[model samples]
Target: MSEFVSQLSDSLYAVFQSETFVLLNTVDQESGGPTSSAISWVYAVDHSTLRLALDHRSRLVDNIKANPRVTVTVFGQDTIYAINGSATVTQDPLAEVPFKMCCFDVHIDAVRNALFYGAQLVAAPEYAKIYDKRAADKLDSQVFAAMKKA
Candidate 1:
């Protein structure tokens, strides 16, 4: 993997236990471009595991069923990570929450790392700091603890 991918992977591992939300973009079947409809979502991850949950009628879910090829971009305080991978929509309940958790965790980890690695690259240092502060506010410790026990 390239350095970008490695950094993204490690960042994901760090915030997997937190409650940060991710914006998911799916290529439109007709337009073949990313769409903005219902693009935002919450996901969890643990190690290499990823989980996503949505209503049965969600467009993104349908898109994944038809085409597993996906590109997931995660935004951090001072860094952004774009991941290209193949995804499958699974019915396994066990993996869902953990994967979503991991996604948030990784995002936080990435942001913290960016402070040291790319602080000067950001447009506003204060913006990044604000995001870091907000990350803790959104965490659901009870849910996370329950998921781990399962």
Candidate 2:
């Protein structure tokens, strides 16, 4: 991958790991056009593979099935990264669980970082709350225990 593509992938991974959402665009094969769709729910990311949770019936899915070409856009505080790649839909029962778990872990890590850095401005309120609660609960039960005891 080129530096720009690598940066875009890293930025996307960061955003997905935090927000669990992204703006996904796919190219229409027959018409050779682009269709933009908001995929706010992603299943996970393992290395370079980005697994998104989308309806099998949706146009975006259809578009992807027809043509694996896709572009994913992730927004940060001051920077936006666009990733161009190919996506393949998988229905493998055995791989499903692990893929979802990986995605969840990435999200958890993102939540922790966002809370730690006070970068909740770019996240949805409910998402921030969920992550904040997780962080608070973890700290309360572990690192912050000494302070509470003191």
Those runs of model 2 whose alpha carbons end farther than 4 Å from true positions after fitting are: 1-3, 7-12, 92-150
* Residue 94 accuracy (lDDT) in model 1: 31
Q: How well does candidate 2 score on lDDT at residue 109?
A: 15
Query: How much lDDT does candidate 2 score?
Result: 0.48
Tens digit per residue, CA lDDT, model 2, 56-108? 45676567778877776655554444555666544412133222211111111
- Candidate 2 versus truth, CA RMSD in Å, comes to 12.1
The residue-by-residue lDDT of candidate 1 on 24-83, one tens digit each, is: 656776667775432233445555444444444456665665665655555554565555
Instruction: Summing lDDT over every window of 10 consecutive residues in candidate 2, give the lowest-scoring window.
Output: 101-110
The candidate that achieves the highest lDDT relative to the unseen native structure = 2
Deviation from native of the Cα of residue 148 in model 2, angstroms: 36
Model 1 misses residue 6 by how many Å?
Answer: 5.3
lDDT of 1: 0.46
Candidate 2: give the clashing pairs: 44-103
Give the C-alpha miss distance for residue 7 in model 2, angstroms: 6.4
Q: How close is candidate 2 to the true structure, as a TM-score?
A: 0.53
